[model samples]
Target: MTEAKAHIVAAVAQLIDEHGPAAVTTRAVAQAAGVQAPTIYRLFGDKGGLLDAVAEHALATYVSGKTVAEEGDPMAALKAGWDTHIGFGLANAAVFGRLTDPARGADSPAAAAGLEVLRARVRRVAATGRLCVSERRAVELIHAAGTGAVLTLLAMAPENRDLGLADAMYDAVLQSIVTDAPVRTADGPVAAAVAFRTVVPDLPMLTDTERALMAEWLDRAAGA
Candidate 1:
């Protein structure tokens, strides 16, 4: 994208972040971007189009920043990917909300981008030889659990919408799915953690190295 278009998109995102999606208006975006309102309409067609572009840009930027772990031990990579996914969501709450909100379904390019990311992750796991042909269902289950955990965490405590909370939720849900084990579903952090472990047993325990990588990825993703 050109610098001008990128700036416009970033301005729109900032507006949404500061004022929520309902506050986003063509005139407001154009003013924030130092452009004329007609320019926005001419380039994006409508307010929905601008929102869609922002969502798509955010998703593409986020997914592009991810490292996808290494080429070996798909399980390890899968765990790493889960961590990355949750971390991105926590760090970009406004953008994540805009992408996942069902009300935005008609214009949500981010949702489609997210599904593509999921499908690609599944394909990678399937290629690892760790899963049998009959285990495709397991892969799907794990993916669903991972996403579910993230959404659950966001819903439960908007305040705990940080990387730590995201990691705990993902780990709990992940363990449940992978171990076929029962997990607590109480209304606390402990319950969230347990749910994560139940769904994703192989969820990376995380390390300083991994955290450092995540920080780097976030820096790149935020265009900083």
Candidate 2:
């Protein structure tokens, strides 16, 4: 981005921090950025565009500070990711609200990226035979839980917020998505089915058509 574009994004972010999303007007941002209204228009098209830029920039900045755990328990890593997500939302409420907004949702690039990261983490859990559901299902459940937790906290006044709510929500989501151990006991069939589905595309012994058919059957077997 050009220096001017960066300036405008930063200025808009400051306005959001000082006030809120509703306070971000073109006139206010233009004045704060020391740029004319038309410059913002020319650079960002409009206030909506400017806010999008701010959200993307702010999210990326927050994500940069996150440390990806290279070695440890997969479930532990997943919990770390969850904690980072909650921290980001609490620290950047306006940007997080925009991300969780029904209309904006995954339409925002950052939100989509975040989901992909969560999917990869869920895949790691599935690979370990701990996932009780298909990888996709687990990801959706975890995402929904995390988003709901953050939004629920944000909706309450700070002192009134139940700090344990987020942890409880995570536990509930994890219980739904994972087994106490590797699915080697009574749930063996479900775990095997899910683990096999993840490797379906890599099965060179079978033709694409055969692999696809096998995947369909596995999908049913996994109850996905």
Candidate 3:
């Protein structure tokens, strides 16, 4: 994306994050981005288009920041992936909610990309010999559990949003899975290696440029 387009998308994301999706008007985005409203319409087509763009941009941004080294133990990779997933959710709660909202449509490219990330993580876990048995089922369960935990946190406290709650929920879910796994061991390092091998490959892959852009985004998100 061009600098201009990226700015507009970032502006829209910020608007939605601060004021909810309902507040994401072209005029508002234009004003925030320091561009004309007509430019937004010309580039994005309509509000729906702009919304889709925002969603896509957000997902791409989120996926880019996630880093799991190829050489790490499987269990460590899984923990890192889980941490990144929940951290992104907690850091961008409103954006996270917008992606999952039914209003966005399940078939939307943004939603598909989001699901792809989860599926990729599952696949990575299966690549490790530790989860050789029932790998498919295990991946599916992990994805389901993670999603459920996030949604449950949101549902439980509609009025009070807490980043800690998201972390706690995901930690519990991950702990449960790790504890029950056949490969789990009493040794922390060994357990992490097992988890890392099982979960790292299941994540989305991004090019170097995408990763740099995502890193910039996370820096901005932190400062915001």
Q: Pick the lDDT winner.
A: 2
Candidate achieving higher TM-score, 1 or 3: 3
Ranking by TM-score: 2, 3, 1
Between prediction 1 and prediction 2, which has the larger TM-score? Answer: 2
Candidate 3 lDDT over residue span 59-172, tens digit each: 787776655455756666675676676666656666677677777666656445655665555445544534432333455566666666676666666567665765676566
| Per-model TM-score versus the true fold | 0.60, 0.88, 0.61
- Per-model C-alpha RMSD: 14.1, 2.3, 11.8
Candidate 2 lDDT tens digits, 76-188:
88999998888888888888877667776566666666777887777777778888788878888888888899999999998898868999999999888888888664648
Q: How much is the lDDT of residue 27 in candidate 2?
A: 77
Q: Which stretches of candidate 2 lie over 4 Å from their true place?
A: 64-70, 204-210
Candidate 1 ranges with C-alpha deviation above 4 Å: 1-4, 102-124, 132-139, 160-224
lDDT of 3 at 145: 62
For residue 216, model 3's alpha carbon misses the true position, in angstroms, by 42
Model 3 residue 206 distance off true place after TM-score fit, in angstroms: 30
